[model samples]
Target: MKDRLASGVSIALLAALVAGTWWAADYAKRAVKEDPPRRLTHEIDSFVEQFVMVRSDEHGMPMTRMEGDRLEHYPDDDSSEVTQFRAVSQRTERPTMTATSQHARMDQDGARVVMRGDVQLRRLAGQGRPELDIRSEEVTLLPDEDVAYTDLPATVVNGTTRIQGRGMRYDNVSRELKVNEQTRVQIVPGSTRPAAPSARQPSKG
Candidate 1:
């Protein structure tokens, strides 16, 4: 009788251990399945110094500039750069132009920049329009690409032209303007009406 009782107790304990082990395994598997993947983060030791940007011009005079720190370039997303950030000093200069602005984010793939908080652009030489003063929540810049657009409407004063548009895209490569909905472009001393290019008939040589 005593042997039978001892055997019964041992069986109960073994069964309990197996049941507990199975429950713990199921819980761990469920936890892993419900969790999301993590993003990649790289720790930057220090910022870059004197990053230069250059573009070829029609006159053979390429635009060149040396931009200082607080400037970060992330190869992943070409959409934003932290310019003139409070953490570091930033500066940009060119032969024909020198401009300064605070808080800039440039995209990696696309030719776009989001300048924030007291943004300014200037031309050192050429016309009397020495500077472009802009105050906006955000300003998009496609400098050489001439393809800048914003989600929110912006007030821009570039040289003699003042433009108020919901969004604007200028293709420097093609020299064309892609105005978004409710766009208002005013060329100083010129009419605001859209011009139709003269149609040409095909000619046989």
Candidate 2:
């Protein structure tokens, strides 16, 4: 009877030792594990300099191209900003257009670009379309739609004729330029609008 009791006691102590060892191992694992960190609202995800990105249309044609000296992306806001930025639009219905700005903000999956600080936009002469140029303090560009607008003082030139306005919206699809208020008009009398190409069109850059 005494021998049986001694054996039982030994078995109980062994079980407790195993249980304590298991618990200690689990505690060690949990103490060393760490949780993932949460991102802040303004946290930046990426940054680059002399960056270039090109986007294509559904038809596999290059639709928009963006280039900049510096680019920054914020994952929290799902937006991007660029310094010394330039963008080019290549749409089938319109001539290739280029825009330059000291600063640019891109949003909504790059469908919209807001350009600031000495914005200049130009459309290369092509397909019988004369060269068009615009200079403004700021301009909003929609690359997919080939549209641009500005509410600040702006100057637009077609050939030798220049028009100054406080605000304007240009739609490449409709081939219309709407001005909110006309400020001035300058024309060189001897110079005429560039004649549309005949059978041969000028090559565009």
Candidate 3:
């Protein structure tokens, strides 16, 4: 009788130990498994191809035009993205300006535009100012404010002057251009390049 009781007690202890070990292993497995990844909210809700958007002034004059091969809008942030984008500005009394980029993002109201990848800006010659061109990797534009800026390396060409700098800023309305850091300026000695002849202009006699 004594031997049987001892054996039974030993078996009970071993069973408890096994059960405890299994429970611990199961708990560890549950803990090691990560929770399911949270879904991202940056999904595009709408998109357009060959998109064109124009903004006009109160006097019914077009101030700006934006075009893209594709435009995508996200409902989560009320922002829009564009691929192969180009923007043109013809604000009153200001030099006509154009911008092109591989990609761009605009705010909900189109007040701001951020361009990336091979960004280029061009300001047409007007009001005695020579034509200006700028190239950069990225640029930020505030259409309402008539301001554009970049913090990356940039190259500016104004008439015969070529400037290389680390950063740049320009105000369309004010016609002011600034370089954040002085890099180099190459001034080609020559008159401004002449405009192309008009297509309808008669050949010289």
Candidate 4:
């Protein structure tokens, strides 16, 4: 009987040890699976997917339209940011202009936008107007004024005409482009249609 009692006690102790080990392992697993406490954070607004922004002219006409994959607004600076953004501008006398970039920033109710990372601007062809393209690393745009500018290296292309410069300003309203520094123009005289006869210098003696 004593031997049997000893055997029973040993079995009970073994069972308890096994249960305790299982409990310890379960506790450890739960501890590792639990998520850490979230930090306190606040923002005015944020958006993911299907983000659109529009800015209108003083006359209440739609001047610029912007769309993106992600948009975030910060009340602290009254500014907004966009990821994978594209924008379009409209004017009465000229073809619609569009821009695309990897990221963008805007303030003052999107009156102005600054875009970065492989920026490309294009003028849509319409009513015998030829298409134009501008490529740059960065650009600042005033859609209300129908203007865009960049201080970085820039390239402008239209048909077989190409312009390269360090800084550039383009006015969609007036169809004018001003290059600030290190400007070069290449035109295919026979193949490419002439675009800016008004900008040519007069013949000299």
State each model's CA lDDT, in order.
0.47, 0.82, 0.84, 0.79
Decide which is better by TM-score, 3 or 4: 3
Clash count for each candidate, listed in order shown: 12, 0, 0, 0
Alpha carbon lDDT at 65, candidate 3: 92
Where does candidate 4 clash, by residue pair?
A: none
User: For model 1, what is the error of residue 168's alpha carbon versus the real structure, in angstroms, after optimal superposition?
Assistant: 2.3
Write the number of the candidate with greater TM-score, choosing between 2 and 4. 2
Put down candidate 2 lDDT per residue, 12-109, tens digits, no spaces.
99999999999999999998977779856876789998999898989788888999999999988788999999998878777778999999998998
lDDT tens digits, residues 10-111, model 4? Answer: 999999999999999999998787777854454756655768877776788777888998888886677888889898887676679999999999888888
Best by TM-score: 2
Estimate the TM-score of every prediction.
0.42, 0.73, 0.72, 0.68
Tens digit per residue, CA lDDT, model 1, 131-153: 44333455566656433345556
> Model 4 compared with the native: what TM-score?
0.68
What is the C-alpha lDDT profile of model 3 across 1-205, one tens digit per residue? 9999999999999999999999999999988978887665999989999999988888878889999999999877889999998999987688899999999999958989999999999999877777889999899988777789988998888777777878788888777777777578677757654332122331110
Ranking by lDDT: 3, 2, 4, 1
* Residue 179 lDDT in candidate 3: 76
Which window of 10 residues has the lowest lDDT sum in candidate 1?
Answer: 196-205
lDDT of 2 at 179: 62
Whole-structure CA lDDT of model 2 = 0.82
Q: List ranges where model 3 is wrong by over 4 Å.
A: 1-40, 190-205
Q: How do these models rank on TM-score, best leading?
A: 2, 3, 4, 1
